[model samples]
Target: MDDLTAPTGREEALRAMPHPDGTAPRALVLGATGYLGGRLVPRLLGGGYSVRVLARDAQRVAAFDWGSRVDVVEGDATDEAAMGEAVRDVDVLYYLVHSMGAGKGFEAADRAAATTVAAAAAAASVGRIVYLGGLHPDGVPLSPHLRSRVEVGRILLDSGVPTLVLQAGVVIGSGSASFEMVRHLTEVLPYMPAPKWVRNRIQPIAVRDVLHYLLGAARVSADISQAVDIGGPDVLRYGQMMNGYALEAGLRQRAIAALPVLTPRLASHWVNLVTPIPRRVAMPLVESLQNECIVKDSAIDALIPPPEGGRTPYRTAVGLALRRAEVDEIETSWQDADVLGVPSDPLPNDPEWAGQVVFTDVRTAHTSASQESLWRVIQGIGGERGWYSNPLLWAIRGWMDKLVGGVGLRRGRRHRDRLLVGDAVDFWRVEAIEPGSLLRLRAEMRVPGKAWLELRARPDADGSRYDQRAVFFPLGLAGRLYWLAVLPFHGFIFAGMARSITAAAEAADAQAGTG
Candidate 1:
């Protein structure tokens, strides 16, 4: 049994691990931009492993706080040549890539991706492969999503590489797909008319506990090549899990009635109507609830000791997730992935004039405050702190968006004071951010047209020049009419907003100077 943690010294670990050049035990994370992968890189770094991340868009991954710490390789997992380059000089490969949210044929895509990465790891002679997979009970029929996870795990194990697969049920955490589904359902509905599958039992695991197991796997001996089942201390039905969340969220007890006629397809539609999660991601998740996912085997307990405080109870996990959401401290969100209909690149500067119409309201102001102070005020715009202009108008608009199945203002910003490229701020996603210079946001509200708001600040002799612009590309007559209707309000909102932001920045600067 080769000791996974024998080389405790950072310098010694580099030499001991199989690396082309002598460095630390290099760990290459394939899906570093995803929810779990985003959190895992920082932990691996803390555990003394040199980390490198591979992403399709390096700029997207670069927005993460830990991005600067790890070496980033820009490439897609499906590309063999890119995988070969990424796999080289790596001791452990964390295969966290999946395509469940990628619409149809994702199962085939997932299988192909797993095979490609497994072959790459074997070719690179990687010492170990660590994978996080979904839990499915044996002898029970698995959903397409769960089956794909199982197949991927099998592919890695059979690749002649020592693979440690950790199979977990619904991961309870802020921004996790499973937890968000639970959070939205519990928060929005007082009486849930759910499918009969709500009765199915599940063993949910806290994200913290799951991260612990992932990190622990890296320290285990290479002799351990089997799959491990991980779960929280509580085994509960899906409905009961929702009840637990409700209690932790301080919401009144929700009444859930299971309807046999309500199929998974129908339930997914219902989820889409009530939650921010789209139907494509919701359908596969709803389908998987039909099968019981409680952990049957607990063999991993001996291999990796539980965290110091022990496994998180289901209720405790829900509370922690809710707290993180309340404080807007979420590290990663399922929304961090690409939204299907939104533009992948930044909004175009010039409008398409092929019989298309765009309305723009651009305003500029000169503020006698530093660029840093203005940016600080601009970045803190959306959450509990109201938008600087008209609080009542913003509230009314959010309520209307919520009525139309939009995220509204409740999703809030990830952090109160800081703005990240992918962070959700109210109903707008932070599309781009240039520190102390510019911030652009794309509207997620249910609208008849595409819209954006851009803010720019630059240092000037007096202080700084602040500019704000609102751009809308109307789809048709309805979009044009909608813009016309909102034009008067924009004049009021945009003007007042500029004045308010400048005032706030100057006040803060005055207080700082006096103090």
Candidate 2:
């Protein structure tokens, strides 16, 4: 999963192609489990191409919801025998594989895979090869990551198959490594101090628009064979992207000071320290930032006109990404739980589940800190206790909820020091209650989706451990859109909530000692 965003140019390319429905034009997608390839497969299928996917883990490919409509072939893209078999009888081949993140000698591995695919495509007489690569100025010194991308394109072209290369910059969408980096950094840091490349110009495209262009490519005049640069309408610096993301999130102004001393290697390690993202993914992303990645030729635009519906603005793309994240959060099925490595049993101890929708946060802190003690603190949560911190924001959100058919803070809890399952506490309903260990709440207000707050605690070696989870089940597409739109804000609020709960628990323990 490298790039998650789809270029509008790819959609334009697909739309320009005639439908393969009746004749069932055979198409094969290598690396179908990867981010971009994950999206490209469905788009290709929807465009009426008979899609076959080649993946190292065929089970993962089979797990996708694309249904029985597509064929799943188990094979490593780099394997010559596998590549040959996968490309057999295919009319169009999409080379979406990359050797990065396989540890050292990734370039050599990438070159090998490209050569294998190209040779197989040529051998099979595959008519076209659509490849996605990076957008870097030709003839300039390239980063290892970008260099590998360009060389891969050359390998495919040299095989004598008519190749359509689509080179792109940053792609903005959920699950995209690049987009995730930006989203996490901008949302977590109140202000950012970055490397000098933050000032470098670049263009960003949306995943949806990219899907559109990929579908368009299938029908594009078979004669057009040159590389095309795909991008969104806006050209901005990396710094500007940070600022724009901040504004859209309704977050405070993100101040960034570009430092001369921070190199990409150092920055990648810094990224690992600040984010859950691994260093391998961050290094290539950061190194590429040293160059300006704005689109150069309008040749692609001229070849694939906006009238065919492939152009989208940067802001719109970002907005779509946020909304899509929210929607995905709500509609996320139990199948995703397997991928997330969540325990199958809902009551699994020491487990956590997270959900987000809009810009509000609600968490039920669970601990071995006795139900009475926990309820005491929860009942007195507002007013003088001040909600641990950020009472103002809590008050505002509560008021908003109240204005739209919610009890808000005014109702407080009944029987301030005790609670039972199914009992109503202010605007929250106790969905589950296990004395001394767990608490769960179901919201009674109008929201983007069905929402809940849950807490589970068990004794730890020291004293006790706590786990909190917010859950949302989206109603439809709108509900999903709502969850992603507020995902980052949820991260901030949750962080504060965790700190507050820990502090309060410690204080309560201290008070018991004194008494």
Candidate 3:
């Protein structure tokens, strides 16, 4: 992913679409915390538009690097007072939110949110409303998910305010849910048994091109208030999409068996078992896949020119998506912005995981090792250095993770010496890092619930103190049972890990003194 704060040399060009008062037009993004909205906000800022975001959690928005750059109005869209005030001073509003994972009455929830935005935008006299909706066939009976999207688009257009709705199919990118789905399913299944929807044809768009068109839409005429389709050059069947990912990942082609009896519900459960996607999110996505979605015309080009050379082809997009994994760096992931009980949150030394049953195993060791040596060992915990514990157990765990389509331990670190907050270390994602003090790693392996490992080093009277803790939050009965199953291995894995790490630090410090 391109740096969100970098200037694209087109800031001055946006001056042509200036506000009525001769200022840089301010754009208010409704779903600023979402995947598409999070990406769009920084580009809007880079393109010379003053941006504001409506966020339910202001602190979450503030955590982003570009958070301080944009104005934040903390509120939900369904709240009438908040929506009215949020749209008041904005010239353009981007509606990138929908009720995808909301269980029952999701259609009602989406309709209500869209209705609120339409009314608020019209009442505030916002310049233009831009929305991103799914691309579906014309006269077919749409699924509840696709039907709700179409209804939301109609709500925006019927409002007195001019709206431009960009309809796109499966978006292909490093962190995109669709791309992740394709990647995991292809990697895990050599011989696939899929639902009949795997044969459906769809036009997948690259995330960069999606951003390009969204940025260009800001400059389009207010008269263009209709929904336009945007997508990549080549259209392929869903099975072909999976094979495309397999090709980019340098894996052999998969043999697919499309079974007619497998329903969307069953397919979602299968997806949950294989990929990181939760069943709720997968259900709607699977249902929508039943339709064949493709660009019917070249209408988007007349308003917004093709991205530089042209739109990315399907295979090329897959390659771009795979490049991040190859380098062990995914800027954002579907997990970061997906369904419930996501394990991305920090450990509960405080109240981060309050009211939940948190199981923990704590270990401490005092060693005749310099603080610097201890810090180095803690920082280099994963990757090629290994976990400083039983090799067979670690290997077995990694193999199990790979079998279930998890990232596994093969995705080493970005650097051998240094560490960053977002860097990937084997099957763990670096959650927090304090120089010479602390490192917290969140588990990315497929588990029933959330898990984290924390390591800390501090200066003692003569040497150093090393502290290690393993924390887990159970989801349900299954999550609790999983914790019990692994509890016995704590002696072999966690305790030995702590003792080995301290011993290694002592050895390193002794060697340094001799040198």
Candidate 4:
């Protein structure tokens, strides 16, 4: 190759310009508490870069699994002083923060934060700045969220510092709002209606591949200071994506019909009612799908090379996500417990149902059986062992769930007598389990709200105490109605189940004594 086409020594050498004193290149990550940032920190650390994060609450950052491994600067991103403090002595700056809300003015908020960080990075003379932006078709009207993301990329690129903006579409992974929408919508509705955007072409990328490009961006050639589009190997319609997820999740291929009149607002409300994702997060995600979002060129491959085995195929990505969701032990990792559509702090208590409304039923029973027996009965509560209630009632509910395309009772248990953090038993996923004290199951059945069942076994002076609770967090008026309509059966189902459990334990004790 000619000298002009050949790579320069400077390009080949890892320039520690930001830390010319020979120390490791320092990376400053904003939005460390957000989804992508939380995943990227460890990747950067593993890539041999020292990591620092600027968070409004240092404790929240510390709460992550990789928290203690890096330095945390407590500050808000919009504050100039705070941004400046965070940018000081940083080599590469990563901007992964963005906001999506149901209300107005989020655009202005995003613009301001981006401007502040860009100015800070420029002033600090950081080696390079890396920004994660959304992929959108050019010259087309964009959703407010996508528009703001593109604007933020412009702000960072124009900051007088070399910037590598990696634009990605619909990141597929657990905990991603986009992926969660797909997961819940497919799991809840077998026949999806309306939304012409469902047919728009979308190039979805996996989270692992996104992180690969992001990590490479920290050292992308200083000469490249433009946005590079990245995506998976295949481009599929939004409907195709949903059905792909269904195939991996072992559900029937979803039948989706595009209704011309279904607007994003109305669609989001429908999503809220049918899925665990609330309207607030679902609205922006739905709107972003209104236009085609695909990679524009091969520029990204030139700069960051495809992930190790090449970019993940859409179906392969879906399968990996389903498998990963089964057993991620880290509290902040991608294992999406079906408790909520996506992760947000649990709604705080308030008098009104304006936002959060939780309904619960409690039943207790006392018996002359040891706690061990009671726990054995409690832990083995579902799938063939039975729900400890009327078998007819359990079968009816299971059929009802199956009719709505929910997981139903068919999944059963992974082990006859063993339960783990993410094991699935019938229509419930084991959320939490304490050896002999409590077994909590999160409902995966199609419902208007979130639901959980707790079976507790405690030792009493005489023998053992068995307590059972059914908790439901209603989504809206529909969710409220769902709870009310089913309230009458609680006495027969829940109360009897609690009593039956303790009785069975006592029967075991009596039978053992007879032996």
User: Highest TM-score, which number?
Assistant: 1
Per-residue CA lDDT of candidate 4, range 1-515, in tens? 21111123322233333455657888999877666777778767756688899976564565456878998888766899988889988889998877665257778888999989988898999889999998999998998889999999999999999999898989887656677678888998889895999889999998777877787787777888999898998999999999999989989998999999999988877775565455565677788889998888898867876655567788887776666556532223222222223232332334554555689898888889999989988887786788877788887887777554454564456446766555567777766678899887877777998788888999898998988888789888999999999998888899889888999999988888899
Candidates ranked by TM-score? 1, 3, 4, 2
Superposition TM-score, candidate 1 onto the true structure? 0.82
- Residue 1 of model 2 has an lDDT of 18
Please give the ranking of all candidate structures by lDDT, highest first, separated by commas: 3, 1, 4, 2
Better of 2 and 3 by TM-score: 3
Cα TM-score of candidate 3: 0.79
Model 1 stretches with alpha carbons more than 4 Å out: 1-23, 220-224, 250-252, 323-328, 339-343, 347-360, 368-370, 386-409, 442-451, 460-463, 471-496, 503-515
Tens-place lDDT digits, model 1, residues 214-292 = 8777767888788889999998999999998888878888999999999887888788767766666687789878888
**TM-score for each candidate, following the candidate numbering:** 0.82, 0.62, 0.79, 0.66
Task: In model 4, state the lDDT of residue 379.
Answer: 81
Which stretches of candidate 2 lie above 4 Å from their native place? 1-21, 307-310, 329-515
User: How badly does each model clash, as a count of residue pairs?
Assistant: 1, 30, 0, 0
Better model by lDDT: candidate 2 vs candidate 4: 4
State the displacement of the C-alpha of residue 245, model 4, in Å, after optimal TM-score superposition: 1.7
| Full-model lDDT for every candidate | 0.81, 0.66, 0.82, 0.76
Query: Comparing 2 and 4 by TM-score, which wins?
Result: 4
